[model samples]
Target: MCASFIVAAHIEQNLSIRKTAAIFSVSKSSVQKLVKQQKIEGNLEPKPRGKPRYSHLNNSTASLREIVAAHPDATLLELCELFGQNTGNWVGRTAMCNALQKLGLNRQKNSEK
Candidate 1:
């Protein structure tokens, strides 16, 4: 959306770099650089940046909840294998345990279990 807005401001709206940046609530030099790049490449696609998402939580939540509910006493490694087999996702043991912990299932100390 930011890329689209920047492209629209520069191409469709025919706005100057400074004016485009001001209108888009971004830095003037930012707009100037984008405009320069667009003019050079004739492209406006936004580059992908930032850390990549590891898990697809949207679809995994139901499976995770079911697994946790079915086996609250399951170990971290057990949960990881179960999730991987059932949902076709190989989650790290630590990550799976952390997720379970977030859902109120923490590993008990040696004496507690």
Candidate 2:
């Protein structure tokens, strides 16, 4: 917020974008973006940077834990397939592994003798 205000003020004072960025120790692109935003919106505040991440596994954590408990020998791909079949929401193997890790249910591979 302070950086945006400073950039706006510098732009208002007839400072070039490069000079404003140098004075503020920010990137030239940041100064350019903030200046453009101020011109369009009459304010220097930036909107949220990126899209919010949506997780399909959030509501299925309990069910996933129960499934893992019931089938401890299931591989990650098998678990993911089962979850997709049960919930009708397909998730990748990486997401399934991460979800299991978050639930403190890390799978350990057995050593081949």
> What's each prediction's TM-score?
0.48, 0.59
Per-residue lDDT over 1-113 for candidate 1, one digit per residue giving the tens place of the 0 to 100 score = 37667867787988887788778888888877777778887876666799877754335777889987898778888988888889787888768766766666556745655
- How close to the true structure is residue 6 of candidate 2, measured as C-alpha lDDT? 65
* Candidate 1, superposed: residue stretches over 4 Å from native: 1-32, 36-49, 109-113
Residue 82 lDDT in model 2? 89
**lDDT of candidate 2 over 1-113, digit per residue (tens):** 48666665676798888888788888889878877777788875557889987778987888898889888999999998889888899999889888888888979977899
lDDT value, candidate 1, whole model:
0.76
